[model samples]
Target: MEALVAITIGTLTAVGLYLTLRLRSFPVILGLTMLSYAVNVFLFASGRLVQNQAPIIGSGETYADPLPQALVLTAIVISFGMTAVIMIMAIGGFLESGHDRVNMAASDPADADQDDAEEGWA
Candidate 1:
């Protein structure tokens, strides 16, 4: 089960990486989301495999590691913050430029040259 979970996470990360390299903003966002999900699962799995057990020790015979659950929850919250920032960046870029082309600003040679000239002057 752990191996299967690892494999699934690996596949998700691979697909996310592929999507993240695309020339569109939406796909990149989607990829980032998938990658975050994979990372969360991977992190959660790091606490070791526990089946049919509760992390709380109120009245259970088995207690799972609480560290991993804590870490994963923290990661999920952080990922949400990151996702919100990325969404704002993407939306702001689209609104400012009227397009969602990935790396459009950096891909323009004219802009690059102008930046270079500005840097040289500075």
Candidate 2:
């Protein structure tokens, strides 16, 4: 069972990474979401993959690590906020540039020269 869960997590991470590398905004967003889900699941699973374990704490119960569960829950909420912000930024970029390119915006000449100098390129 543990092996199967590990394999599943690996597969999900791989798929998410692959999708993340695509040349599209929506797919990248989805990939980020998938990756976040995989990471949250992996973190949650680190508390031991106990079956039917109650998230609540009480007497006479073998509870899984509550810390990981709490952290995962926090991550999920934070990811939702991040997703919303990314979506709005993407939409704004699309409106401004008329394209959904995910690559970094071209640097200004001044900054480019500074960066080159910093990198010892010029």
Best by lDDT: 1
TM-score of each: 0.80, 0.76
Per-model C-alpha lDDT, please?
0.85, 0.81
Q: Point to the candidate with the largest TM-score.
A: 1
Model 2 residue runs over 4 Å out of place are 55-58, 104-122
Cα lDDT of model 2 by residue, 1-122, tens digit: 89888887888898889989988788898888888988988998888988877666773367667889889989999999999999998898778767786765456332235555556453
| lDDT per residue as tens, model 1, 1-122 | 98899898999999899999998898999999899999998987887888888888764877788898999999999999998999999999889767888864666553445556546542
Q: Roughly what TM-score does model 1 have, to 2 decimal places?
A: 0.80
